[model samples]
Target: MATRAVWRYRAIFAMLCAAIVFFALLPFGAGEGGVPGPDLIVCLMAAWILRRPDYVPVWLLLIVLILADVLLMRPLGLWTLILILMSEYLRRRVDHTEALPFWSEAGLVAACITAAYLVDHLALVLLLAETPPVLGQGLHALATIVFYPATAVFSQVIGVRRLAPGELDSLGTRA
Candidate 1:
């Protein structure tokens, strides 16, 4: 029974990661202007991390973020590192943050996203790569922060509920 539950959870995690990558690669209409893409992938990742960290193990999160970096053609391991750290931070705080008001959670996400972007920007500057305009990065961060609530709702609808303390065994528990 535990083995079956573990497989189910792994399958769901894989599907969600694949969905994020697939949707990110899908082209929008030509009329769509601006930053070129929404950070929906990050939003979903953050949602899953905050809501159910056990389902999103550190190794799996690393694999997904690295895959995203390769797919999105950004600097290798840049976002992987940033998001892994962010997810770890959120995972540690999930117990407390889950009890806070929605807006407070949003604020937390916003701060993290902003920090990630800033780090990316600084990395680009240090590397002397031609970076996108700051305004566009700002807009992208805003979109990501704004999209968190929707992603959280979608995650919940898909049955990824926040696990209470001592609820690990409700599914196959993870270390």
Candidate 2:
């Protein structure tokens, strides 16, 4: 029963990510003079991973992020690589961070995102690839950070939550 719940929530996370990517590809106003939206993918990933680390395993993230990269026309592997690393970083710290207040979680999310953005920018520059404008990327990161709380709330509403004490022990080890 517990394993079933894990798989079920994993499937839910996957489908939500697909919906976010699909909306992103709509092209209603692609590249027009408006603010770039928050990276909802990151928000969802961070929220779900922090709350329930087992549910957003790296393999699932790797596949979904790769698909998003292909569909969104981003430079192959750049964003995917960084986000996977960030996800691992967050996942590794779940035990240490489970009790942190919301702002701290937000701060960690912001910090991870900030680090990912900086590394992404530095890498693109080194590769001589066209990078998005700094101001725009900064705004995008800020928007992502701003939207994280809502994403966390959404995850909670959908029943993706911290593993209960019994559930954790049932897994036979820490996540």
Using all chains and alpha carbons, the TM-scores for the candidates as numbered come to 0.85, 0.94
Q: Which one wins on TM-score?
A: 2
Clashes of 2: 0
The per-model lDDT (C-alpha) reads 0.78, 0.88
Worst 10 residues of 2 by lDDT: 164-173
What candidate 1 gets wrong by more than 4 Å, as runs, is: 1-3, 29-36, 169-175
Instruction: Judge candidate 1 at residue 70 and give its lDDT.
Output: 95
Backbone clash count, each prediction separately: 0, 0
- Collision pairs in model 2: none
Instruction: Please write out the lDDT profile of model 2 over residues 1-175, one tens digit for every residue.
Output: 3488788888998999999999998867437557889999999999998888878878999999999999999999999999999999998888877778889988999999999999999999999999999988898888898999999999899987776654562255676
Candidate 1: lDDT of 9? 68
